[model samples]
Target: MNKFDAIVIGAGQAGVPLAKKLAAAGWKTALIEKRAIGGTCINDGCTPTKTMIASARMAYMAGRSDELGIHIPEYRVDFKAIMDRKSTIVKQFREGATKGLEETKNLTVIYGTARFVDPHTLYVDKNDGSFENYTAKKIFINTGCTPFIPDIDGLKEIPYLTSTTLLEIKEVPEHLLIIGAGYIGLEFAQLFRRLGSQVTIVEKSNRLMPKEDDDICTVMSDIFDQDGIRVWTETQVESLSLKLGKVHVKLDGGGKGPASLNCSHVLVASGRTPQTAALGLENTGVVCDEKGFIKVNKRLQTAEQHIYALGDVKGGPAFTHISYNDHLVITENLLNGRHKDISKRMIPYCMFTDPQLGRVGMNESQAKEAGIDYLVASIPMKNVARAIESAETRGLMKAIIDKKSRRILGAAIIGEQGGEIMTVLQMAMMGKITADEIRSGIFAHPLYSESLNNLFMSV
Candidate 1:
């Protein structure tokens, strides 16, 4: 039995950093993982997906060279090269994470599946088929969630892909049929479509980004339509089968009596489910919600106060940044004796579509649903001089402001460099910068940042 001051199961975004912090603070820490370090973000989620999104963007731009007044006769997309580059980036990130963990003194890296023998004690089934036991004064679970494979009749018998496996295709699929219309599915739809594949998206909900305001959804839906991406909302994927070399899917709902699609590939991007059942949570006082997310307090402590759960496993807003913030929250409370609650933090997220959807705080609908008095301001990309000059005029910038406090409430920027521009607004919200101050702020000319000045003028 190995005894340590801290045990972090799953060297993910939260676990790795927390382990490093604990070690640096002069505590013996054990960081355990069943797979590669760097978790989903570096290995499969953000890094690889964003690298491929960059390649897809290049493919999209090169194909539009003529529109940009750059004469290009022909250009080709090397699907293999794109995947290779993505793999290269992922490898570098993974290596860096491994090195970081190795350099941390007093931290032990263990490769195995970990199960709670009790609250403070865990049994690790090593990859080498050896068994080991460790007990720590404090334990943290950062085992992030995995893609939830939905049970549609006959779906499993045929070869289908999830978001992770789809990123690995060496060849651009002829026709790509996606199972969901959420962020992951939408990004992949645009990515593969721009990479020269015909794409179709099906959503059980009535609109794109069901959580967004109708107006925002309308704009994005229009953009997707113009891009020639077929969408079927209010639809249910009834079943699936293999026909010849292609996959066939049967669909229902959507007001159409019956619909079916035959595509070279099918991607299931419905959602993700937390990884907990394997951890043997049943053995500990640590309680998980009905949905399997570890129930944590504002400080991220489990029912067993000495144990904490972070990142996707804790369930709300499964962004890598959120997980990193979770590390901060835990480290602050543990080492500094300061409580930094996760609930009050501002979160910004981006969808890597061509006209990226960058969002921070609440939108109009959210504020309205909460019965908060809010005012909104918006402008089209075509009105922005930079967007017009760049010929990437396809989206809008919207800001929602609080009517009572006169502060910036929330913002959604869906245009070229939307995420970058949205960060400026995010910082404003973070600092409690007022709407009037943002409106009067001077910005450099003919840039996306300049649009910020115009976007806030209305409210």
Candidate 2:
């Protein structure tokens, strides 16, 4: 049996950095990964999708260049070229991450699938068909989640795409049908529609992005309508079958939509399932929730005190940033002897659509559910000088403020560069800057941030 001071299973965003830091702090570490060094973010999720989205955004803008007074005769999306670019960037990122792990002192990079044999022991089935048992004083589980495959009839017989496989298509889909309307489905819906595919979204929720406020969803719906992307809400996919070369999808529950549709491709983007099932947690004292996510305390420690769970495996927020932050919390609390609590952090996320939806803190629904007295401020993108000047006025910005404290509770931006604008507001919220200061703040003219002045003025 091989032994180490520490072992990190899954070389994901959290595992890579945590292993490096632990090794740098003088602990011998083993970083075991079943696949590529970078986890979903670099291999499948954020990096590749964002790269393709960038190409799609470029194609979208080139198609409308005439409106910008830059008349272009024509523009075409070379699907292979876009895929190649995405592949190139993904490879670059993976190579960099691999290099970082391999060069780190006292960190051994292992290629294998690891499962707990006990609280401090793991058995690895190496990729080379070899096996090894490892014991460490401390263990960290950073294994991320995978796309959830829903249980629809005839789904197994027909070929369907998940978020991971959708990126590997040989050609652009003729008609792309997506199963969910959350962040993943919406981003891909806009992405393929801009990439010249006939796109349709069938969501089980009553409306698109049910978590967002009604007005935000309305603006997003309007944007999708303008892009010619069809959306059916409160719908469920009953079954799927292959008819000729096309996939016949039978959907139900939409009030006024066709019972079924035939599409060249079907993407099941419903949600993700935690990657803890195969971790052999049953052999250890560590506990998992009903969803198979490892249960961890605020310090990210599992019930087995020496074992820690980080990132999507622990199951609060699934964003890449959240995973990286998990690493920071563990590193600080463990290495630096600081008592950093993971629960004290704010969660910020951005949906990378044409009009990006960036959110931080609480929204109106959460405030109402919590019974907090709140005031709202909102403005359309058409009212923003920068958005109108750029001819991309398709969404709005909304903010929720505490009525008693006059402080910004939460904010949402659904305009161009919405993520960046949302970060500025997040900083203000972090600093406890009151709504009055934001309303009267001097922001540069004709920029998206300046709209915050207009947004908060009405509050």
Query: For every model shown, what is its TM-score relative to the native structure?
Result: 0.98, 0.98
lDDT of 1 by residue, 95-131 (tens): 9999999998999999999999988899999998999
Per-residue CA lDDT of model 2 for 157-215, tens digit only, reads 88889999999998999999999998999999999999899999999888899988898
lDDT of candidate 1 at residue 95, scale 0 to 100 = 97
Q: Name the weakest run of 10 consecutive residues (lDDT summed) in model 1.
A: 253-262
lDDT by candidate, in order shown: 0.91, 0.93
Regions of model 1 farther than 4 Å from truth: none
Clashes (candidate 1): 0
- Candidate 2 residue runs with Cα over 4 Å from true position: 254-258
Error of 2 at 115 (Å): 1.2
Best by lDDT: 2
Relative to the unseen true structure, what is the C-alpha lDDT of residue 449 in candidate 2, on a scale of 0 to 100?
Answer: 97
Find the 10 residues in a row with the least total lDDT in model 2: 249-258
Measured with C-alpha atoms, the lDDT of residue 163 in candidate 2 is 95
* Alpha-carbon shift of residue 295 in model 2 (angstroms): 0.8
Candidate 1 TM-score to native: 0.98
